[model samples]
Every structure is written in C-alpha cells, then in structure tokens.
Target chain A: MLLKDTISAALEGLKRSRMRSMLTTLGIVIGVGSVVLMVSIGASFERFIVDQVESFSGDTFEIHAKGVQDIGKDVLSITFGDLEAIRGLTTVKNIAPAIFLTDRAKYGREEIAPMILGTTKEIFYNWSMKIDEGRLLSDEDDKGAKSVVVLGSQAAEDLFQNENPLGKRITIGARKFTVVGILETMGSPLTAELDSMVYVPFLVAKAIKGRTTYIDYIALQSINGDNELTRQDIVSLLRQRHNIDNPEDDIDKDDFYARSMEQAMEIIETVTMSITLFLGLIASISLLVGGVGIMNIMLVSVTERTKEIGLRKAVGARRRDILIQFLLEAIVLTLIGGIVGVIGAISFGYLISLIASKFLGDLTYALSVQAIILPLVTAVAIGLIFGIYPARKAAALQPIEAMGYE
Target chain B: MPENDAPLIETKNLQKSYFNEELETPVLFNIDLTIKKNEFVAIMGPSGSGKSTLMHILGFLDHHTGGEYLFQGQLAHEMDEDTLSRIRATRVSFVFQAFNLLPRASVEQNVMLPLIYHPTIPESERAERVAKAIETVGLTHRKNNLSNQLSGGEKQRTAIARALVTEPDIIFADEPTGNLDSVSGIQVMSALQELNEAGHTIILVTHEKSTAEHAERIIELFDGRITKDTTEFKTRKAKEEDSLQK
Candidate 1:
C-alpha cells in the first residue's frame, strides 16, 4: 500500500476511538513534560548563579586560613606579615587583611546589631561596593587608629531610620565610632550577609578585641586580572612565610587555600548540570510506562480490528505493509505527545522565570534546541520499541482465519 | 472465437481438509472445475456441503491441501504469498456476505479501498475510477454516506463497487445477498448480473435457487463433491425480477 494511504488509514482508526487514544498518550505527555521542565529550570538556575557570581569583582581571590580553630589559631592564622609580603608582589593590584565581628550599635536611644567588617581603605578597590552617602574609610583613619566606620545600606536604615548616618556617632562594644560612609544596596543571594554589615578600620577593630585578633581573611586583587600567576605567587609566599617545609606539590599540607571567583562559578555550573541529568533520568521511567501503555492499547486495537486486518490483507496488503501501517500509527501518537510536552514545558518555564525575576535578578531562561530534539527522538524510539509486537501480530494473521474471527 | 484461449480458472483433483491436533476432517474431495472469461457461474450447495470452501480456494483466500489449480495458465496453487497478493490486488477481487465495507468510512471511501492497494494505478486516476465503480453499481447518490448508515442493499452495492474499482479479471461474491430482505436481495443480485453482462467474469457462491438462477452456469456440490454442472440457455434476468417484485 502507498504510505499516504496507510497514514490516513491509521489516523482514521485513531479517530474512531478518540478518548482512548488521548488517555493512552497521557503517560508519554507527563514523561516528556518533566524532562523538558528539568532542562529549562536547570538552565535558568545556572544563569542565576552566573549572574550572582559576576556581580562581584572576578579579578579578586580570597585566601582563608584553613583549620585555624582546630589547630591553634596562632599557628594557622593568615597574619599581617603574610598580607604585607603579598602586597609587595609585582602582579598585586591591591590587598587587605580583614577582621569580622558582630556587635550591637547605639546612636542615642535607638539600637541595632550589625555585622562589623574591619579592613583597610584599599579593601574598597578589591570589592565592587559603591558609596551611597559619604566617603569611604581613609588611610589616615588606619594610621591614627581612629574609631571610624562605614555602614551598609540596610544597617544604616536600621540604626538611623531616615536620619543621615554620615558624621553620626555610634557605640560599638566599648568604643565609639563615627560613620563616614553608607554603601549602596546590593540585590543578591548574599544580600542578608553583606548588606547589613558595618565596616571599620582594621586596626581599631583589632584593638577592640584586645589585640589577640588574627587576620580572619586576606582579599587580593590581581593586576591585569591574571589570577593564575597572582594566586601561585600568594600561595608560595604564604607557605614559605608560615615555614611549611613540604614540597610545592603538597597542597594538603598548606595552611591556607585561595579561591578565585571564576573557579566558584565553574563549580556551580557543574553541580547544576549534574542535578538536571539526574532528574531527566527519573523522568524517563514515566516514558517507559507510557510505552507499555501504548503497547497494551495497540494490542487491544489489533484484536478489535482483526476483521479489518483480514479485509486489508484480502485487498492485497502484504505482511510488511501491515507492519508499516501499525508502526506508523504508534510513531504518530508519540510525536503528538512529544510536541504537546515541549510546548507545555517551555510555557511553564517562561512563567516561572517571569515570577522568579521579581526576587532574583534578571534570569535568562532559554530552553536549548538539544533539549527539544532529544526528547522528541526518544518519544519516536519508544514508539518503535513498543510498537513492534502488535504490528507483527497483525501482519501474521491469515486472511481466512481472521475474517472468520468473531 | 475467444473459446480457443485458456480457461481463466481451472482445478483438477482439488482437495481440502481441516486439521486439529492430528485429526484431519476433509471438507472437499476430488473436485474438478473449469471457468472461462466473462462467465457468470454459481457454486450452489447447502451448508456443510463444502461449496464455500471451494470458493475460498478459488479466490486464493485459503490454500487447498491437494490440488492442481491453474489461473491464467499459471500454477496458482503453488504460488508464493507475494505472487498471490499481487494477483489478489490486480487480477481478482471479492465481495463477502457481510459486505465488508469499513463501517466508519463513506461509500466513496469504501469503494476507493481496493485502488489504494493497486500497485500500478496512478494516484491521479483513483477518484475517477472510484466514481465510475460507484456509478456502475447505481450508488452515486449515496456515495458520501457512511456504510454503517446505509441499508443492507446499499452496503452490498458499495462492496460491489469496491470489488469493481480494482478492474480485476475476476470478481467473487460469497453469499452476497444472504443478509438482505427479498427486495434488497433482488437489488444486489441485479447489480451483480449487470456487471456480468458488461463482460466481467463473476463467480458467486449461494444456496438460494432463485439467486443461483441469475447466473449463466451452475455447479452443484454434494458432500464435498461436484454432483452436477449445467449451462442454462436462458438465465433469469435479475432486473426484470426486481421490477416484478416492486
């Protein structure tokens, strides 16, 4: 028989039992929908993380002392000497040692607790923070050991509440400090941690802690953004300064580790991709069940149409022709399901991106072409794999026997 | 005359049997028959007389266990499945007692079915051929009606149009009027007789004496064997009978 006629005939058969055909394709619809949904959400999540990571300066590296409290803090601390030695490197653009403390602040009768980040004036150039109200900490403040501070936008709002915080005095633990600047609002995943912090000169914060405070972390900016070379120089200088005698290859023996912003982005991308593929694998089980449903209905169809099959054979349809007709029917059914699923997932993804962008920064959620094509191909393969047995049974029927079947 | 040519169909020592778990029950025994082109022949017998079995073997719908069956001077009984299917598609067609029209399809679509399987028929000519076949059976008015919605006589005429659409060398009708009322039966028989008169070779299987008398020749079977063969000089005209009944 001509392929055109076979296709029309298969369509006619399906149209005869419209409700059953729809119900039979439901499993495939759900399976393909979930797979495409996973891909869309995964791509959107990766883009969100990339946006958050790029919001900060990518040329900077953070070196944190590992196991400082487990080992003695003094033995594992990243100290002032290590920070000054790194600052002397030719590739270093800027460097600062930071100390972090959380304490309550008081201005007249109003009181608020804020995270206190203590670092030098050069720390502004290493991070991408901008001033909203007043000037940042000056080098004179560090040299004079002045009790001066900069307030994050949210901290300023909580402490002063519509009142100008610049030039205002606030008490931090046992010291009084003058607020010199207020940072702009940072809309990010780390907004709670960064946007509520008050910045003070590093030396003053150390004095507040009675001079036992070791540098909590060192932030370094690489000149020309060459993080690889700058990171190698910093790691070797710190290892040598701490007197670790292990070979250069013994990374586990190092007391401090440095991570660049670019490396963190790559790690996030890899983790999100793994989650997408694992969810896709789980979605395929529903596709398997869908295939079984197709086979079962096709079997019922073949039995119910025994007389029709006999008539077709009598009109000169060969075994292969009958096989092709039934297989084409199965494939057409799955292709419809695949198309519906792809459209549903794409619309759903767009809806989610629209709603989620209100809270997170602009998220670019685009479904890749591979995500669409692969699921459609899988749907076709499932049809073929599950369609064979019923097609063969229809093909092997003897005309006389089949016609006489009640 | 055309009588010098080979007969369109022939059988010698034809035999058939049904086997179930090593038990063989013979249905036809030592049957010999010959039919020429443009012959309207009826095989007549009561149920269980094996007349239907003989028609099935002749139509290539079933295989005879023992036979020398020739179609157009070729060994038809020994033909493979592909060859038989090719013959079925182009050289022969059948109309069953059930009408066998696709219930969900229109009469036009039902008649177009055999042409769908015809290997050499150009797609451009299919609709024209289907129209011509439906016109021949006098069913052009109801061509767009679904077969299930038609009366018994209309359905049988649609089946006849399906069989004729292929323009096969031979047409087989198996108890074509068995399910119809007398008026509808005469209408169907008249259609078959008119096709026969138009120089088409037709083989009909029927137990009704009146239905068999519409054919030019009759072969009677008794207990799986041919008991009599006769050529009637004046065959009953189904159109005249249909008018008389009306």
Candidate 2:
C-alpha cells in the first residue's frame, strides 16, 4: 500500500475517538514539557554563573592561612613580616594585606554596621578597584597612618542618602574618619561582599584594633599575567617563612594556601555543568513514565479495534499494512504532543527570563539546540518503542476469527 | 494459458479442524465442490454445520487442513500469504452478515477502500470506479453519509458496492440479510440478483430455506457433511410485493 493511504487510514481511526486520542497524548505533553523546561533553565543558569565568574580580574591571586584555629586572633601563620618578605620577591608586581573588622559607622544618627576592609593604597591599583567621585587612598595616607576612609558606592548610598559623602566625616566606634572617595560599582558575585564594605588604611585599622600578629589574607597582582609562576613562588615563600621543612608537595601539610582566579573559574564551570546534568536526569524520569502510558493506551486501542483490523485484512490489506497503520497512529500521537510541549517550554522559559532579569542584570534565557532536538528525538523513539508490540498483536490476528469475533 | 472452460473454484477432499493443545475437533469432512463463473450458489446449514467454514475457505479468508483447492486452474491451497492477499485484492471480495463497513467513513470512502490496496489500479481511476460501484448498488444518493448513519439495508448495499468496486471475479456473502427487516432483505436480495445477472459469481450462505431459494443452486450441509446438492429447481424471484403482503 502507498504510505499516504496508510497515514490517512491511521488518522481516520484516531478521529473516530477524538477525545480518547487527545487524553492519551496528554501524558507525553507533560513529559516533554518538563524535560524542555529543565534543559533550557539549566543552560541559562550555567551561562549566567559563567558570566559572573568572568567579570572578576583574571590576573590576580589570593593567599590565606590554611586550617587556622583562630582566623583573626593571634595566629602566627601570616604576619606583617611575611608580607614584607613576599614584597621582596621580584615576581611580585603589587601586593596588599587585608584585615576585616565589622563596626558601626555613625553619620548624624544614620548608624549602619558595615564590614570594614583595612588595606594599603596599593590595594586600589592591585585589585583594579575604580574610583567614582574623589581620590583613592594615597602613599601618605598609609605611611602616616592618617584617619582616612573610602566608602564603597553601596555603603555611601546607605550612609549619606543622595548627599555628597566625599569629604564628610563619619565616626567609626567614636573615632572620626574622613571619607575621601567612593568606589565604583563592581557587579559580580564578589559584589555581595565587597560593594557593601568601607575601606581604610592598613596601619590605621591595626593601630585602632590593636592587631599585632595576623591578617586575614594577602591579595596580589602577578606581573605579565603569569599567575602560575607567581602562585608557586608565593606558596614556597610562605612555607619557608612559616619554617615548614620538606613538605613534599603535599598541600594538605602546608600552613598557607595560594590559588589563582583562573583555577577558581574552572571549578565553577565544572560544578555548574554537574548541577545541570543532575537536574536533566531527574526530569527524564517523567518521559519514561510517559512512554509507559503510550504503551498502555496503544494496547487498549488495538483490542478495541480488532474487528476493524479483520475487516481491513479481508479487504486485501497485508500484515505489514496493518502494522504500519497502527505504528503511524502512535507516532502521530507523540509528534503532536512534542510540538505542543516545545512551544509551552519556550514560552515558560521566556517568562522566567523576564522575571529573573529584574534581580539579575540581563540574564537571557536562551533555548539551546539540544533543548529542541533532544526532546523530539526522545518522543519519536518513545513512539516506536511503545508502538511495536500492539501493532504486531493487531497484525498477527487471524482474519476468520477476528471477523467472527463477538 | 487461459482455460476458457475451467471452473472458477474447485476443492477436493476439503477438511477443517480446530485444535486445542493436543486435541482436534473436526468441522468439515471430505467436502468436494466445483463452482463455475457467473453462478449464484447457496450453502445452507444450521449452526455448527460448518457452512460458514466452507465459505471462508472458498473465499481464501481461511485455509483447509487437507485439501486441493484451485482457482482458475492455479493451486490456491499452496499459495503464499502475499500471493493470496494479491489475489484477494484483485480477483476476490467478501460481504459479511454484519455489513462490516467502516462505521465512521462516508459511503463513498467505504466503497473506495478495496481499490486503495489494489496493486495495479491507477490512482486517477479510483473515483470513477467508486461512483460506478455506488451507482450499481443504487446508493448514489447517500454517497456522502457515514456508514453508521445508514439503514441496515443501506449498509448492506454499501458493502456490496465495496465488493463490486474491485470488479472481482467472485463475491462471497455470508448471511447477507440476517440483520435486516423483510422489506430491506428483499431489497438486498434483489441487489445481489442484479449483480449475479451482470456476470459476477456470488456464493451466499444462509440457513433459511426461503432465503436459499433465491440462488440458482443449493448445497445443504448436515453435521460437517454435504447432505444434498441440487440445481434442478425454479429460482425464487425476490419481489417487494411479497414483503408488502406480510
């Protein structure tokens, strides 16, 4: 028989019970919809995270004491002496020590507790922190331990409330500090921590807090973007300064850890991809259930149309004709559901992107090529997998018995 | 070679049995029959007499366990499934007692079904043949109505049109008027008589002696055996006046 005739016959049979056919295809629609939804959302989220990770400065590295008992209180693993020693290395282009203290800043009854970062003037250049209004801290500010502060843009906004806080005096724990500058907004994951903090000269903060032994971490920029060599030199120098002998390249035994930002970007990519795969796997279970549903409905259809099958056979239809007819019916069912599901998922993805862009800047939820091809291929394969048994049963029926069946 | 005088259907020592595991219950026993072209024959029997089984075998809808069956001088019993289906598509057709039309299809589509599977029929000629077949059965006025929407006689007439669309050499009809009223049954019997007069061979099966009188020859079956075969009788003419008298 011609393929056109077989397709029309299959469609005619399905049209006989339109409501049953549509209800049978609903399971496939739900299955493909969720699968597409998960895939599109997962892809968009990964892209969003990767874009955030790429925004940070790639030429910088950070070093901190590993497994310290007390993070900021009297730990001798990293000290001011170690910082001087690291600055002595020729590969060290620029470096600054950072100490964090949480304190309330009062400006005429507008009191807010913001994290205060204590570092040198070189930190502004080493970390590539831009200035929005006034000047950053200078060499004189650090060397003379002047009582000066630079407010982050978010911190300035909160403290002054649309007023110019550039040269204004704010009290930090009863000591008056002059705000010399406002740093530009850094939009990244790091923004949550760095954008809301106040900056001060390293020596002034040390003098006020009476910190003599340890700092939290050391931030440095590598010369010529050669972070690997700088990272190795820093690790060795720290091991030697802390007086650890022959640690045999076991980082677990080292007193301090040094890592470049490039390595952190790779770790983030791997973790996000894994999360996407895990979510996609969970969504595919519904597709399996949908396949089983197709099988069940197809079996019922075969039983209900036994007399019809016999009539067609008696009218000169071959066995394979019957098989092809029933199989095409199943494929048509799944193909319709797949198309509806793809449209639904794309609309839902666009809706999610619109909602997400409000909190995250310009997150475009795009449907990847895999999102389109995978669900459709899976739907077709499900039809074939679940369609063959019932079709074979229908084809193998004896015409004499079937025609006379009560 | 085309034999001008050969019988259209010939069956010798035809036997049929139903097997359940290791047990066999015989249904037809050593039946010998020969039917020529353009003959209207009726096989009459009560229930369990295997008349339906004989018609199924002769129509190629079934197989005989032990028989040598031939159609137009070719061994039909030894033919493969594809060959049997090919012959069925081109040279043979059937009408069931239930008037087994596709319930959801229009009368025109129901008549056009057999031509869809004909291997040699050109696509352009299908509509003409379907219209001609429906005209033959006098169903041209109800061509577009769904089969389920038609009366019982109309449905039977549609089945006859479907059988005629292929211009088959022979048509087997089992209990054609079993489901119709007397008036409708007369209409259907008259339609079959018209087809037989137009040189189409028809094999009809019915248990009613009155219905069997409409055929030119009658073969009576008793307990899986042919009890009598007689052709020397006056064929009854089915008329609408008889139905009106009742």
Candidate 3:
C-alpha cells in the first residue's frame, strides 16, 4: 500500500478514538515536561554558581594558614613575613595579607555587628574591589599609618542612614577610624558573606588590637605567563618558610596553604556541574517511565486495532509496512511531545529567571543547549526503544487469526 | 474449454485439516477441481461442510494441508507470504458475506483499496479505476459516504466494487449476500453475475440454493467432499443473458 494511504489510515484510526489517543499523549507530555523542567532548573543553578565565581578576579589566588582548625579560627599566624617572602619570588606581582576581626560598630546608636578587614592598599587592585564613594586606602595611608576605614555598601547604609559616609568616623572595638571610602556592592559571593564588612589599614588594625604574628588570609597575583609555575613556586616558598614537607599534611600543623583561583574555580565548577547533572539524571527516570508509557499505549493500540491489522494484511500489507506504520506513530507522538516540553521548559526557565533576578539583583538565567537537546533526543530514543516490541508484535500477527479476532 | 491448458484456478488432491490438539479434523478431503478463464461457478454446502474453507484455499487466504494448488500455472505452495499477498492483490479479489468493508472508509476509498495494493497501476489511473468501479457497483451517489452509513445491499455493493476495482482474474465471494434480504441479495447476485459475464471469473461459496442458482455451474460439498457438480438446467439462458447485459 502507498505510504500516504497508510499514514492517512493511521490518522483516521486515531481520530476515531480521539479521547484515548489524547490521554495516551498526555502521559508523554507530563513525562517530557517533568524531565525538561528538572534539567533546566539544575542547569540554572549551576549557571548561578559559575556567575558568582567568575565575578571574582580570575587571575588571583588565596593563601591561608594550613592545618587551621576552622576558617573562622585564629589563623592569624600568617603575617607580613610570609607576604614579603611570597613577594620576593619572580612570578609574584603583588601580595596582600588580610586580617579579619569582628566587632560592634555604633553610628548614632544604630549599633550592628560587622567584619573589620585590615589589608594593604594593593588589595583593591589584586582583588578587583571597587569604591563607590571617596577614595580607596592609599599607599601613603599604609606608609604614614593613618587610621582610615572603607565601609561595605550595606554597612555604610546601616551606619549612615543613606548619608554620604566617606570621611565620617566609625568606632571599631573602641578605636575610632575615619571612613575613607565606601566600597561598591559586590553582591553575594558563592562562598563568602561580603555585605557586612569594613576595610582598614593593616598596621593600624594591628595597633588597635595589639596583635603580632597574626594574619587572617592573603591574596596573591601572578606575573604574566605560566600561572601554574608561579603557583608551584609560591607553594614551595611558603613550604620552605613554614618548614613543612607536605602542604596537605600542614592542614593539621601551623603551616600555610596556597592555591590559585583557577584551581579553586575548577573544583567549584566540577562539584556544581556534578550536582546539576546528578539531578538531571534523577529526573531522567521520569522520562524513562514516559517511554514505557509510550510502549504500553502502543501495545494496547496494537491490540485494539487487531481487526484493522487484519484488514490491512488482507489487503496485501507487508509485515514491514505494518511495523513501520506503528513505529512512525509512536515516534511522531514522542517527538511532538518533546517539542512542546522544550517550549514549555524554555518559557518556564525565563519566568523563573525573571523572578530570581528581581530578588537576587540581575542574576542571569542560563540556557544550555544540552539541557534542551538531551531531553528531546532522549524522548525520541525512548520512543524507539519502547516502540520496537509493539511494532514487532503487530507485524507478527497472523492475518487469518487477526481477522478472526473480535 | 479444453482441460489441457492451464485453468485460472486448479487444485489437485487438496486436503486441509484442523487440529484441536487431540484429533485432526479434515475440513477439505482429497479433492480436485479446475476453474476455466471467466467461468462463473458456486460451491454450495451447509455450515461446517468446508465450502468456506475451500473458498479460502482458492483465494490464497489459507494454505492447504496437503495439496497441489496452482494459479495461472504458478505453484501456490512455492510462493512466499509476500508473493501470496501480491497474488491476492493483483490476481484475485474477495467479497465477504459480512461485506467486510472498512467501516471508517468512504465508499470510494473502499473501492480504491485493492487498486492501492496493485503496484503496476499508476496513482492517477487508480483513481480513475476506483471511480469506474464505484460507478459499476451503482454507488456513485454514495461515494463519499462512510461504509457504516451504507445499507446492507449498499455495503455489499461496496465490497463488490472493491473486489472489482483491482481488475483481478477471479473474484472469490464467500456468501456475499448472506446478511442481506431477498431484494438486496438479488441485487448483489445480479452485480456479481454481470461482472462474471463481462469476463471476470467468480467462485462463490454459499448455502443458499437461490444464490447458487444464479451461477452457471454449482458444485455441492458434503462432509468436506464434493458430492455433485452440474450445469444449471432451469433459467440458464435467462441468467446468462442477464449476466451479459451488464
């Protein structure tokens, strides 16, 4: 029989039982929709994390006390000595040692807890930090030992009540420091709480707290070319200075740990992407169930249309022709469902991103091609895998017995 | 017609049996028969007498358990399933007692089915043949009507049109008018008779004496064996002329 005639006849069969066909297709729709939406959400979350990581300076790395009990514990053992030794290396462009102290600050009795960070002037350049108002801490300020502070945007708002806070005095654990600059909003970091912090000169902060041989963390930048080599050099130099054989072993010792931002980003990306794909794979179970649904319905359809099969066979339809007709119906049904699910997922992703950005301040919604194509191709494959048995069964039916079936 | 030449349909020592697991019940005994080109014949028997079974074997819808069956000198047993289907499509057509029209199909589409199976006919010419078949069956006014909407005789006529559209060498009618009233039965028999007289060979299986009376020859079967084969004595010339007028 002609292909057009066969297809038209199949369509006629579907039309004759419209409600049944629609119900069968609805199972596929839900199956495809759930899979696509789940993967889209997972992908969006991964993009959110990647965007947060990329917001940091890609060329920088962080150094902290190895074997530190906790990141919040007294890791002040890293001092200017380590920073100077790191700077002596040929591949080291700039190094900044950071000391963090938490204290209550009062501005007209609006008291709030905020972090106070003490670092050199070069930290602004190395870390890509921006100042929204006034000026950043200058090298002259670091050299002359001035008592000046930079307020994070949130801290500035909390203390100054929308007034320009630059040049204003803010008390930090009893010593008053002048607000030399107000830092721009950095939004939320993937791993840090940066909104409620204050920055001050390293020497001044040490003097105010009477601290010696203590530093919180250090930021390092490499000179042009071979960042891996530079990172190795810095690690070796720190290891030698701290008298540690293995940096990993130093995690329990009072040694120092150094790592490039690229390494950290790679680790973070691997973890986040693994999580996304894990969730995507979990959602694929539903897609598999949807495929089985197609198979089940097709089997039922083959049974219900036994008489039709008999008629076609009686009219000289080949087994392959019967097989192809049923297979094509299944594939077409799934592919159409896949398309609808994709469209739904894209629109839903957009809606979610719009809502997220409103609360999260311009976070981008990622549209991954794999997220779209994987589910569609998976749906088609599911149809084929599940459709084969029913097609074969229909094809194998004897013309005499099938015609005799009620 | 000389018996030496190849008949349109021929069977030798044809035997068919049904196995119900315990016993082999033979439905067609060791029978031999020959149908010439364009001869209108009917096989008559009561229910379970093997007339329908013989029609199925003749139409190539079923295989004989032990037999030498030939269509236009080609051995039936040697043909594969695909080849048998091709023969059914191009060389023979069937009209069932229930009219077995695809109920969802329109009258014209039902008539067009057999031509659809004929690979030699161009699609354009198939449409022309379908139109001509429907016209010959006197269903031109109902060409667009679904088979379910057709009356008993109209449905049977549609079946006849479908059988005729392929322009096959023979038409197998297994009680084509079994479900119709006397008037509808007469109308269907007249259509079949006309087709036969127009040089299409027809082999009908019927229990109704009146329906078999319309044919030029009647072969009687009893208990899976042929009992009588004879030419019609009464109304022979009138029936022949009626068949010829079409």
Candidate 4:
C-alpha cells in the first residue's frame, strides 16, 4: 500500500474514535509535564544559590577556631593575637576580626533582640557594608572612642522609630553607645540574618563586655597573584598558632568547617542539582507508565483492526508494510503528546517565575535544552519500545482467520 | 486446444482433511479437478459435501493436505507466502457470497482494493483500472456509496468489479447469487456469463440448480468426491444451428 494511503487510514481510524485517543494521550501529557516542571524548578533553585554566592566576591575566605567544643565541653576559644598573626602574614592583604553577641537594645520602653558585631575599621570594606547616613567609624575612633556604634537599617527602625538614629545613644547589655551611622539594607545570606545587627569598635566592645582576649571569627583577604598560596599559608599559620592537634589531618578531613562564599554556594548548587535529577527520575516513572499505556492501546488497536489487517494481507500487503504502518501511528501519537507536554512545562515555568519575581524579588527560572530534548527523545524511544509488539501482532495475523473474524 | 496451453488451474489428487484427534472426522477425501483457461465451470454440492473446501484450495486461501495443485503450471505448494499472496492479488480474484466488500470502504475504493495489492502497477494506472472496472459492473453512478449503503445485487456487483479490476486469469465465485432475490440473482448470473463470454475464466460454487444451469459445465460433489462432471451445449449455439438448417 502507498505510504500516504496507509497514514490516511490510520488517521481516519483515530478520528473515528476521538475520545479514546484523547484519553490515551492524556497519560503521556501528564508524565512529560511532571518531569519538565520538576527539572525546571530544580534548575531555578540552583541559579538562586549561584546568584547569592556571586553577591560576595569569589576570592574571600573565612577563618574560625578548629574543633569548637562539643555540647558537653567548654567552647574552644581563639584570641585577638591569632587574628593579628594572620594579618601579619606575607601574602595577607587585610584581616577583619569579629566578635558576635546577641543582646536586647532599649530605646525608652521598646526593646528588640539584635545581633551585635564588634569589629575593626576594615570590616566595612571587607564585608561590603554601605553607610547610608553619617560616617563609619575610623581607625582613630577605634583607638580613642568612648562609645560609638553603627546600626543596621532594621535595627535602627526598631530602636529609634521615626527619630534620627545618628548621635542617639542606645543602651546594650549595660553599655551606652552613640549611633554614628545606619547601614543600608543588604540581602540575607545563606547562614546569617543581615538586617538585624549593630556594629561597634572592637576595643570598646571588649572593654564593656569584660572579654579582652577572644574573638569569634575572622575574614581574610589575599593579595593579587598570591590568593591560593595566601589561603594555604594563613590556614597553616593559624593551625600552628592555635596549637591545633593533627592540623594536616583536620585539613584533609574538612573538619575545620571554614568555607569561602564561592565554595558554600558550590556545595548548595551540587546538592540542589542532585535533588532535582532524583525528582526528575521519580517523575519519569509516570512517563514509563504512559509508554506502557500506549503499548496497551496499540495492542487493543491491533486486535480491533484484525479484519483490516487480514484484508490488507489478502490484498498482498507484506508483513513489513503492516509493521511500518502501526509503528508510524504509535510514534505519531507519542510525539504529539511530547510536544504538548513540553510547551505546557515551559509556559508553567514562566508563569511561576513571574509570580516569584513579583513576590520574593528573586525569580530567574529558565528552560534548558536538556529539559526539551530529554522528554522528546524519551517519547520517541518509548514509541519504538511500545510499538513493536503491536506491529508484530498485526503482521503475524493470518489472513483467512482475520478476515473471518466478526 | 493444445494440451501444452496453460490451463487457468489444475489439481491432481487434491486431498484436504480435518483431523479431530478425539473424533477423527475427515472433511475432504482425495479429489481431482481441472479448469481450463476462459471456461466457466460451476461446482454443485450440498452443505458439508466439501465443495467450499475445494474452492478454498483452488483460491490459494488454504493448503491441500495431500496433492499437487498448480496455477498456470507453477506448483502452488512450492510458493512462499509472499508469492502466494501475489498470485492471489494479481492472478486470481474471489467473489464471495457474503459480498465481502469492506463495509468501511466506498464502492470505488472497494473496487480498487485488488489493484492496491498489485505492486507492479503505478497508482495512476490502478485508479484508471478501478474506474473501468466499476463502469463495467454498472456501478459508476454509485461509486462513492459505502458497501453497506448498496443493495444486495449492487454489493455483489461491487465484489465482481473488485475481482475484475486486477484482470486476473480466473474469478472464483462462492455462491455469488445465493443472497439475492430472483431478479437480482438473474442480474448477477448474466454478469458472470457476460464476463465468461468475454474470455475471462470463472469458477462458481453453488447449490441452486438454476444457478448451476447458467454455466456450460457443472461438476457435482458428494462425500468430497466428484460424482458427476458434464458439459451441455450452449442454448444460443443450438438455436443458431437449427435456424441454419431451416
């Protein structure tokens, strides 16, 4: 039989049973749609983490005391001397030692719990802090200041409430510090709350809190052309200076728990990507089920058209001809469903990104070639696998018996 | 006629049997028959006399149990399934009592079915042949009607057209007029007679005496055996000879 005529016949057969065809294809649509949607969401989450990582310069690293005491033991402490030792290293550009304490700040009758940081003048530059009002503390302020502070935007709003915060004294944990600046709002970090914080000079905080030797953490900047060597040099020097036992062992094991922003972001991306693919495969089960559904329908179709098969055979249609015709019909049905599902997935992804951008201010979903090609190739492969049995069944039918079937 | 000339069909000891292991029933015993080119022959038998079984074997729709069956002097059993299909498609045609036109197909498409199976013919020529076949069967006016929409006589005529479209060496009719009224039956028989007179070989299986009388030769079957094979002179030839004598 002519190819055109066979295709027309198959199409006419489908047209005669419109409802059944639609119901059969519905399985494929749902299966493909679920896979695409899951993959797109996973990709979007990866992009979100990457953007957050790039917000910080890729070159900076953090330093902390190794093996901080377990719950039953006393906290392992690092000293201000260790920070100075790291800063004095040959490859070091600058270092910012930080002390973090949570305290309740009071303005008349209102009080709020805010994270307060005590650091040197270089904290502003190293941490990307912008002063929106008044001036940041200078080196001289750190040396001679009686009491001075900088409040984050959220802290200022909570404490001063419509009043000028600069020059206003807020009492924190039995100390009064005059606010010199209100820092602009920076977005939240993966680990820290950025909005609710205060900054004060390191010496003043140490004096007021009666803790002069210990600092919580340090951020290190390596000079150009020596970044990786500097990172290694600082880590080794800190390990030696702090008397860290088995320093090489700790470094090999990643048990020190220190990370650059870029590394943290990379870890987040890898984990999210793994989850995405895992969910995608889970959703692909339905796609396989859809393929089975197609096979089932094709088998039923072969049975239903047995007489037609016999007639064609009687009229000299070869087994190969019958096989090709049925296979083509199966492929056509699945490809059509695959295309519909892909369009639906892309459209849904776009709509979700729009809504997320509007509400959360961080929407960047995109469709990848894998998202499109995987489902299409999967559908075609499914067509071939599922089409074989029905095509063979049609080809194998004996002409006389088939013609005699009611 | 020279014996060397190709007969449309020939059979030697063509035996077909059905074995029920439990009942041991045999449907067809040893039988022998031959049909010449351009000769119209009718086989008459009661139900279960194995006439239909013989038709099936001759039509190449079934295999013989134990005998040599030949078409145009080629061994039938030696051909593969594809070759047998080709022969059924291009060399021999069938007209069924049920008017076994595909109910889904239009009259024109039904007539074109045999040609669709003809691999050597191009599509355009097939269409031309279909049109000519339909015109010959006088169904040109109703070519677009579905087979179910056609009358009993018209359905049988469409089957004849389908058989005629391939220009086969022989046409086999299994009770072609069995389902028609007397008027429709006469119409169908005359069509077969006309086709035979035009040098197309036809083999018919019928139980009706009047239907078998239309053929020049009648072969009677009983218990899977050819009990009688007789030829009668054409009535028109007898009348013409009488007029010449007067």
Worst lDDT run of 10 residues, candidate 1 chain A, spans A67-76
In model 4, where do residues sit more than 4 Å from their true spots? A65-85, A88-94, A107-110, A120-153, A156-171, A177-192, A201-214, A221-255, B1-5, B18-26, B99-105, B108-117, B146-148, B182-200, B231-246
Residue runs of model 3 more than 4 Å from their true location after superposition:
A66-72, A76-79, A188-192, A246-257, B1-5, B20-23, B233-246
lDDT of 4: 0.79
Per model, kept true contacts as a fraction are: 0.65, 0.69, 0.43, 0.41
Docking class of 2: medium
Least accurate stretch of 10 residues (summed lDDT) in model 4 chain B? B232-241
In model 2, the runs with Cα more than 4 Å from the true position are A58-60, A66-96, A120-129, A138-144, A187-190, A206-213, A220-257, B1-6, B233-246
Query: What ordering of candidates by TM-score runs from best to worst?
Result: 3, 1, 2, 4
Candidate 1 CAPRI level: medium
* lDDT of the candidates, in the order given: 0.84, 0.85, 0.80, 0.79
* Top candidate, metric TM-score: 3
Model 4 C-alpha lDDT per residue in residues B1-246, reported as the tens digit of each score: 113566668888888876666665566676777889888898999988888878878887777878888787888889897887887777778888988777567999888777766777888897789899989889899999998999999999999998888887788899999899989899888888878877788899998878988888899998898999988735334445789999
Better of 1 and 4 by lDDT: 1
lDDT of 4 by residue, A217-285 (tens): 677666774556766787677667766666454565433444565666777888999999998999899
- State TM-scores per candidate: 0.90, 0.89, 0.93, 0.84
What DockQ does each prediction reach against the true complex?
A: 0.68, 0.68, 0.55, 0.44
Q: What is the lDDT of residue A19 in candidate 4?
A: 78
Local accuracy of candidate 1 as per-residue lDDT tens digits, B42-62:
999999999988988888889
The predicted structure with the larger TM-score, 2 or 4, is 2
TM-score of 1: 0.90
